[model samples]
Structure formats: C-alpha cells, structure tokens
Target chain A: MKSFGVNLLIAVIWLLLSAEPSVIAFAMGFLLGFVLLAVFQRVLGSRDYMRRVFALGRFLLVFAWEFLAANANVVWVVLFRSKESLHPNFITYDVTGLKPFEVLLLSYCISLTPGSTTVQVTDDFRTLVLHTLDADNPSAVRARLDRVLKRSILSFTR
Target chain B: MTMTEMLTGMLVLSGSLLILASAIGVLRLPDVLCRSHAVAKALTLGIFLMLLGLWVYQGEKQTALKILLAIFFQVVTIPVGSHLIGLLALQKDIPRWRHRPIDDYREPGNRS
Candidate 1:
C-alpha cells in the first residue's frame, strides 16, 4: 500500500540523516516511520485526500488555532470557575455513516479540545456519547462539531 | 542558561501548570466523567508541551523526529484510554457528586 511506501521513505530519510549505522537504529527508524505515516493518513489516503494537500495544510492551521484557543478556554474555566458554576453534561451525537476510524479520530479531536471529552461510542457505533465541561448552550457545541470538527474530518473519510 | 534553555525551561514550567490544573480537576471535580475532561485535554497538552520543550532543547533534527514520534504515540493513546475510562465510569453508573440537572444525554432527538 501507499502508506507503506511513506513509511519506507521516512525510514530511508532517518537512516541517511543518522551518523551511526546500526540495526537498532534501522529498526527504530522503521517503527517511527510507521508512526509518522499513520499520523499523515488523512493527507496520503488512496482516494479522497491524495490531491488535497493544501486542504490538509489548512486543516492543520485551523487545528493549531483551535488547540491554542481551547487551551486558553479550559485554563480559564479550570482556574477560575467554581464547581457550582460548572455545567457538565452528557451529549449523544449521531455520526450516522462515518467510518470507524473517522469516528475514533473525531473523538480524539474532540477530546483534545478544552471543554469536551468523548464518553463512549454506541453499541451499533453510529452514535458517540460525549461529556462536556460546559453544556449550557447545546446549539453552540453542536454547531462547532458539525460545522468545524465533523466537516474537517469528512475529507479524511469521504 | 542560554536564551534557548531559558525558553525551554519556561515551556516546561507552563506544561507543569497544565498538569496541575488537570490534577485539580481530578480531585475537585464532582465526577469521573467531568474529571476525564481535565485528563483528556489539559494532561495531554501538558505532556505535549513537555515533549516539545525537550525537542527544542535537543535542537537536532533527528532528536526532534524521535520526540515527534513519542508525541504522536502519546496523542494516539491518551484519547483511546480516556474514552474507555469514561465508558467504564458510565457503565458503573456512578452518580456525580453534585447531582444537578445536567443529564442532557437522556433528552429525546439527541440520539440518532
């Protein structure tokens, strides 16, 4: 598969860059190479993402912004908000037709954001249960997930 | 220490603060699910910052690559682990310590 080639390229690059040559180094390179490849799966997919490298860059930029902003949001809530003020609640969002990996990756992305943590996927795997630090405005949370998070992930899956 | 070293130290310090925030959430937050919020977000970012600071201090491309690998694995595992823990906590059906009106998951049309 093309993913394996990406891994091989990473390994070769690692071998070329290293000063010492050893089997351990090679093995480490191979392993790390696989990790790198998996991390870029969204960008290097066989069908949908192969030609959307620019889109991938855009996604990363947005993710970086979200990560920084979300961290700040969480930092404020955690450091300043009283326990009584906390509006923690559970949400069940229907994924409907997303691939298994898509659901998993989306959950990971959601978890990394400040206010949200994925609780569990449903028995049929079509629904994902989530918990949030704030759920007073359910529409806002749903908007972010659908308009931003879920849409961005669609490029990887579809 | 050099400026780079100073910066690295600052980064690591900030990372520790985030970790502390997650710890406070664990101890002070009313329930397992709520606390998992801290573990999933703050803790992951904290570990990432520490690793990134170390990567910068190393200042070698190869070292940076290795650090990235470590970070990648950490990022991959943390959410999966957190999700499972949250599921277990849900299965145990432990009521939150506060027990307020926050059970939105039971709302109709929320689940499709």
Candidate 2:
C-alpha cells in the first residue's frame, strides 16, 4: 500500500510537471513511476510492488476474458437455449481455505461470471451457497470456477 | 464514417442488443435468482460496452479517464447489489423453481 501510494504520488508529480494535463500524460507518468520503482526496489525497500502489479494486470486480463465469455453465455441461454433445460439450483461451494476478503472476492467474481450467483456464505465462511442458472453439469461449473476464477484470484492475492 | 466511428457504432449497437437480450431473459426466466443472474451479468456488460463505445467516440483523455472510473464503479457495485437482492430473497424463503432438484444449502445437515 505504501509503495502504491508512492507510485501514485510520483505519477501526480509527473502530471503536475508536464505541460499537458492529459490522461496520456498521467498514464505515461504512471508507467515512468513504475519503471523507476522497479529499478530502485532494493533502495526503496518495496520489493513486491512490481510482482503485485503484474499479478493485477494478469488478473484484469483474465477477468476481461471471463466477462466477455459470461456475456456470450448469457446471450446464448437467453436467445437460443430452451428454458425447460435450465436446472437452476443452489449448490454448495467449498471455500475452506480462503481468507475473508478472498471469499468476498470469490463471491463477487462468481456473481459476475457465467451462470453463478452467490446467494449466501455459511457463518463459518467454509461454504458458499451459489445459485447456478444451468445445473445440468454442476461438476463442470465447479471445475471451471476452480480452474479460472479461484486460481486467478489466489494467484493475484497470494 | 471513419473507421473509429464505424467501430463505435458497431459496439454501441451490439451493447444495446445485449441489454435487450438481458431484458428478455428477465421476463422468460423462471424465478428471481435466474432473472437477477441475467441482470447482473448481461446488463453490466452491456453498460460497460456502451461506455467503452462512448469513450472511443469522444477520443479525449479526460473523458476516457472519467469513463474508466465510471466503468470501475459500475463493475464493483452491480454484483454487490444483486447479491444483496439474492440474499434477501433467500431470507424470505422465496420458492425456487419447480424443476430445481438440489438445494444443498438448505439441507438439514448443511445449515451452519
């Protein structure tokens, strides 16, 4: 957080120093700040900032792909698929080892993607109750969540 | 129209079509949970693409920045809002669709 704050500070200083106060200028400044931080990591004592930023970038790319796929899935279900085939049901997802924030993020990501919406979390936070639109293959859903969402989230956070 | 303008128009049109599809899903889906799924995912993506089209059309740095911020907040908030609605419906013991066979959360042994 401190490193991020310093990076933002550097970007803002660059923005102020530059003649054109445009978004490109700000972005350029931010990139410059990122490079500087990377170069002076040992001197600055902020080692993990670059790794976190890269993780964040990867997470964003994965999320964007998921978001597009989600929209496409919804469109298919809504337009082409028959209503009777959809077996909407609440399934339990084991969130045994996730931190509270990671669980929250997982639920939000679940809700945002594909056919799942997290309805409730157990008091112990060990399980999440998710309402899936198409439960014809519940195991498939679980596998996809584990492979795409949970993996990306763990990589970004841990 | 220029290439950028053509691209913007196509994006906006597709976004509108997606939003329309979401509305149709809301009407056609069996229950609240299913309907909310449509609203949360499709509608959010539609709005995002539309804003992206607008950002492309404007082609200004400040406008781009503001639209990016708007998109961020929209993506963050919409899911939370829909999740709360789902939670409330569950709390009210709203009936699930007749065909739904599994409800692991409400099973006697599963309640925490």
Worst 10 residues of 1 chain A by lDDT: A46-55
C-alpha DockQ of every model:
0.50, 0.68
lDDT of 2 by residue, B1-112 (tens): 8999998998899889989999999998888998889889998988888989998988886568798899889878888888888988877978878544564445435454
lDDT of each: 0.77, 0.85
Q: Which regions in candidate 1 have their CA more than 4 angstroms from the true location? A: A1-50, B61-65, B97-112
Best by lDDT: 2
Per-candidate TM-scores read 0.77, 0.89
DockQ value of candidate 2: 0.68
- What C-alpha lDDT, on a 0 to 100 scale, does residue A13 get in candidate 2? 98
Q: Kindly give the stretch of ten consecutive residues in candidate 1 chain B with the minimal lDDT sum.
A: B103-112
TM-score of chain A of 1: 0.68
Q: What are the RMSD figures for all models against the true structure? A: 6.1, 2.4
